[model samples]
Target: MKLDNLYIKDDTRNPTLSFKDRASAVGIAKAKELKKDVIVASSTGNAASSISGFAASAGIKNYIFVPKTAPEAKVTQLLVFGSTVFLVDGTYDEAFELCFKAAERFGWYNRSCAINPYLVEGKKTVAFEILEQLNFKVPDYVVMAVGDGCSISGAYKGFVEFYKLGLVDKIPKMIGVQSEKSNPVTRAFNKNTYEFDYIPPTTIADSISVGIPRNGIKALKAVAESGGFMIDVSDEEIIESIRILASNSGIFGEPAGVTGFAGVRKLKKLGLLKKEDIVVTVVTGSGLKDLKTAQ
Candidate 1:
């Protein structure tokens, strides 16, 4: 469906409630080849649930580390999937460090975004699906929220690869959105520097409140190469985006999912967008993943 100068589609049935299934789908395939026993990953929400779901399907044990600040709905989803959960008193970055040490100590397969190259393989499929569904026609822009940047990077890679394979004629520009308070990437992009000092705990956007994005450097490259722009949106704008997406497009997405729309709105207000422009903004997760934020 089309909404707000962008095309929106639902990716709700990938066994997990969020789009991280695409990452886990490929991670599981690689794990079998490595003959790994345990799968370890760090997530604020959907990635943890997805890893647990896929691990069970592949008969592998799963360990998930998450910040204590994560939303309850996401924590509950991971619990219901029977993942071995570790709640860290520190931030998401600290939880990532602990998971990294554990993975190295136990030789567990790592599905974390920054450390795992194959994780992006699964996420790339979403872009492939979009292009094929459009019958080889490429859009002018593809928008998505940037957390670790894995998903946006994956989608951009998919578009370029598909173009090389004669599946599509061209690659679309990528528009990346990050939470204003927690947006290291957007800060870096504007400053043209690699140094970014993260702020303290924030309730602005829980799904994207990481102090430091592990894949900051690569995520910047994705935006630069795709001829795309990155912007930050306020918590207020994100809340409004959630309502607008659900009401206008018949899609119930979390704040992170609709933040891309918030960015698109920024472009339109700046007179950088047109009504006839074919754009795609990804709904990264179901609204049920964060009911409190949705409400």
Candidate 2:
């Protein structure tokens, strides 16, 4: 709230209670069109649940790989949706590697955003939805948490699509937020470099606890092309922002979901955001996804 003229896009209301639903919806639709019989993806939690649910609806087999540290609720959601869940006894990066290998070997359609371009294409819908909600007005900044970076990159693509269609005059600056514990993208951005160096995650926000983000290249491109920046927020800041968002806006988001709000506060402290500038922060997931951490 201190960031005056700030708006929140409550993507937590999406089916499966996270922004991944949008991406999964699109990916599943495309797979169905291609007559694919199975879809596979790796996620700490949200994307797995989303893909499982969407693939179930489409009458396709779904397989998901998740780090063993992923929350129980998310795993349960996948099981309830009939997904063949693989709990990798390693980091999210390992899970992603295994998922990709399996997808390739089995000829299963990969629904992972980092591996597949169509997932980003689906994720662009969020930007379209936000712009339509705001009556086609482009805000000064659009902020969101990044893990594999598909969401923000897709958002940039949506803005660019609108710009190409002459529906908007300019694209908003994309401000990507990540946890300091798992911030390959932030490290790359801060160092003014593009090389990705893996760092094992040590944060409680499991959804964004990716060490080596597969979409690091595209994510870096989104920030640089849009004249945007990536910032890292501490776990303490993320937890506090979660409570703050729920208290002030009645939006109960998981820690990763409120990570960008923490970034907005940081930007305000640095005097980067003006009171008159409109800022929109995307809340990417529901608190229910990680209720144990929320407590």
Candidate 3:
């Protein structure tokens, strides 16, 4: 793809090696402010690992629930961070429900991205950074992989906030990418509906394999209100993007992390992206987080 200016907002460089760290940082901080001692969350991998790492540094107790299929590397990170890990013998959605109930029962602060409003506050900082780094010049498009939809919504919120404050003239079109094998949001957008039915996801991009997106409404609004569209890419495309991004840009990312780049490629091939358009694709996680899949 020969776009005029395509930038990669590489969140893989975060402390916990994923974009989830931004949310986790805020979640942890909120828990401390609330005087909560224990925090709980459910994730495919990144969120659990991120919160666990931050909680460790903050001396806060954390309980993480992940599906049995969660990548071993992430599980190891959770354990290493001293979190009480629950490997739910079911899908991520099941794990999420269980974690939610557990949090309520135990009175632990829930840090799951979709359920917590404050987490998005931290995630929105990505938009601020992108604008600041580019000397406040807004890009034509901002793309990222959508999991539970919280990250994309956060980004939209950030841009909107900046616009409200007259810090920027316009907000970029927010493009949300999903795996073809697990694309409820894309399906909903294509159908022009806001309500999305649960479609059990079976994608190799574990981080984005959400069947029932908790923040689906906000994500759909982000795409629609910003004059953006949702797109789904094949797993093969995502894997290939990992290689392409690394070989060309020296940026190594996991499958889900590179999904946005894959979408950018697809968009260009489909004639949706103009050659003169400035685009930024957010690489949300490090390849090291899922070494086996990357290999």
TM-scores of the models, in the given order?
0.95, 0.97, 0.99
Q: Tell me the tens digit of each residue's lDDT in model 2 across 1-295.
A: 3655899999899889999998998899899899998889999999999999988888899889999889999999999999999999998889999999998999999988877877887889988988999999999999989898888998999999999999999999999999889899999998888788877789998888988787877888998899999988899999999898899999999989999899998899888898889899999999999988889
Which ten-residue region of model 2 has the weakest summed lDDT? 1-10
Candidate 3 global TM-score: 0.99
Q: Which 10 consecutive residues of model 1 have the lowest summed lDDT?
A: 1-10
| Backbone clash tally (model 2) | 0
Candidate 1, residue 290: Cα displacement in angstroms equals 0.9
Tens digits of lDDT, candidate 1, 183-274: 88888889987666677637456667777888877778888888987888888988998898789778888878777888887777777777
Model 2, residue pairs in steric clash? none
Candidate 2 has a TM-score of 0.97
- Runs in model 2 with CA error above 4 Å? none
Better of 1 and 2 by lDDT: 2
Q: Assess candidate 3 and give its lDDT.
A: 0.94
Q: Give per-residue CA lDDT, model 3, range 17-81, as digits (tens).
A: 99999999999999999999999999999999999999999999999999999999999999999
Clashes of each: 0, 0, 0
Candidate 2 local lDDT, residue 134: 92
